[model samples]
Target: MKDIAIVAYQQSDGVSDAGAVNEVELIMPVLDRTFEQARLDSAQDVDFVCSGSCDYLQGAAFAFVAGVDALGAVPPIKESHVEMDAAWALYESILKIRMGHADSALIYGFGKSSPGELPIVLSQQLDPYYLAPQWVDSISLAAMQARLMLDQGLITERDMAEVVSRSRRNARSNPHAQLAGDVSPEDVLAQETYLSPLRKADCCPVSDGASAVVIATVEKAKEWGLPYAIISGIDHRIETHNLGMRDLTDSVSTRTAAEHAGMHDGKVDVAELYAPFSHQEIILTRALGLGEETSINPSGGVLAGNLMMASGLSRIGEVFNRIVSGEAQRGVAHTTSGPCLQHNLVTVLEKA
Candidate 1:
């Protein structure tokens, strides 16, 4: 496979609620900035475009189609859309780049969860016939996962609080994070629970956000003088859709994706993992074989603020940020979709 690299990335500041800004107004500038940072003109340098987003967020079908207009499609750019997160779309774009069908590509993901009841909408992602009717919200599902982890002795309630404290504390330095501050595991534990074992602090706040990345082949990266990070390997896998059919304490899909992406080959310099809940991060860290030496979610990660479809892509953009800023030579970013880690994607990146 041809080597593909992320050449540019940009993200909008995540907010608790992005008022009345339409998706186009919110994303157009980000798209423009990403292409500019890549040192490429959108209409000239880009060969294909792929996006990750969901219709449920907007309460309308084809919500992603309008976001595509942010690319200024009068010239008719090659494009596709995924009902999943933008990282999955990025994965598709990478496949195209590897095929020699395109040298450079752009990918974007957007989510605005503020206008309506966020959790209610996410419940629809479950099986329509069996799960949707139950209306199990995202936080409760995460709480279930947390309870299982607790039962397995993989983590404790105190550990969950610590994860929340650390993630939000790290967000203080991140200008784009929606939640950031210092709190104690004891303080978090003392808070009221939204669901037993899951407090408000443990749950990611609903957010409005968007993010994008520009990727190019090795030859094209040299041509544009773009800061590049090699796409060493990319892979994703799916697990049994029914939460009851699988072990809730661990993510098998994440393990498969990491192994397929060759994450265990050598020492990893850094990692950007997309885990909206603190427990999921623990599960992912174990599955990816990431230990104390590996820097995980230096960008504060999704627990600071999860804009649904945008969180996964934002993780990719975070690793690209590290590469371009000369922080490390090698890294990995992982993304997930569906309930309780039903789908997972992993990408290995290196600065050359």
Candidate 2:
């Protein structure tokens, strides 16, 4: 693969509800900031443009076409869209660059999941005959996964609460985070359970937001004279759909994806994992073999605020932020989709 570098990343504030903020409005400011940072005038300046969003969130088909309004329609631009998280959209853009189709690309993802029952809406994405028909919400599926972990002595309730506590505390430094404060494990355990074996604190709060990233070849970055981070390696993997067949306690898919992404090539100074649920963070951390040497979710991750389609991209963006700011020499970012982390993507970033 051709060496590529991320030039810029920007995101909107994570809020529980965006109220009357239309999709275009929510995305415009983020695009402007990203463009400014990348020294580009508009999406037209990039060789290709791709977005990540879900039509289901708006209850209409081809809803992402409206996002074009934010991108400017008069000038023709090469563009595409993906139904999955924007992190996957970044994956697509990376392939486009490596294939020599383009030297630079703009990628973005947006979501407004507060308008409907997010859990129920996501349930439709599950196996139609076996799971979707039953209308099992996302929380319930995760709760079952948590139960399996608990039954096997993999983690304790206190362990889960500790994850939440760290997330909340870590989010304090994130200006865009929705849930950030000092809360201890005892405080988390005191809260009543929203679902069996899973407290509300253990779940990510629904959020409406958008995030954008710009990438180019290393030569392009040097020509632009902007500090950047190199994308060392990336890979994605998925497990069997049948929940009963897989080991819920371990993230086999994450481990496989990490190995393929060259995560063990060197020391990982920081990691931004897209773990919507607290326990899943522990699962990913252990799966990646991260220790005290690595900082996990220093920006509080999705648990601070969950933007359905965009959080995955935000994870990668977070790592880029750390690297450019000199907080980390190399970092790993992880993203997930489906119930109980059924599908996973891992990305490795390094200082240039």
lDDT of each: 0.85, 0.94
lDDT of 2: 0.94
Displacement of residue 262 (Cα, Å) in model 2 is: 0.3
Lowest lDDT 10-mer window, candidate 2?
Answer: 72-81
- Candidate 1: worst 10 consecutive residues by lDDT? 36-45
Q: What is the Å distance of residue 54 in model 1 from its true position?
A: 0.6
Runs with alpha carbons beyond 4 Å of true place in candidate 2 = none
Candidate 2 clashes: the total is 0
Give one digit per residue, the lDDT tens place, for model 1 in 1-352: 7778888888888898889888898788788888778876674568989988888787777888789778878767889988889998888998888788898889889988787788788888889999899999877888898889888898988888888888888889888998888888999999988887888888778888798888888888999886788888889999988788899888888888888898788678888888878888888888887888888888788888887787888887888788878887788999988887788999888887
Candidate 2: tens digits of C-alpha lDDT, residues 1-352: 6799999999999999999988899899999999999999999889998999999886778878999889975678888899999999999999999999999999999998888999999899888888799999999999999988999999999999999999999999999999999999999999999998999999999999999999999999999999999999999999998888998889999999999999999999999999988899999999999999999999999999988899999999999999999999999999999889999999999999
Q: Write down the TM-score for model 2.
A: 0.99
lDDT, residue 280, model 1: 87
* Residue 350 of model 1, lDDT score: 83
Residue 145, model 1, lDDT: 88
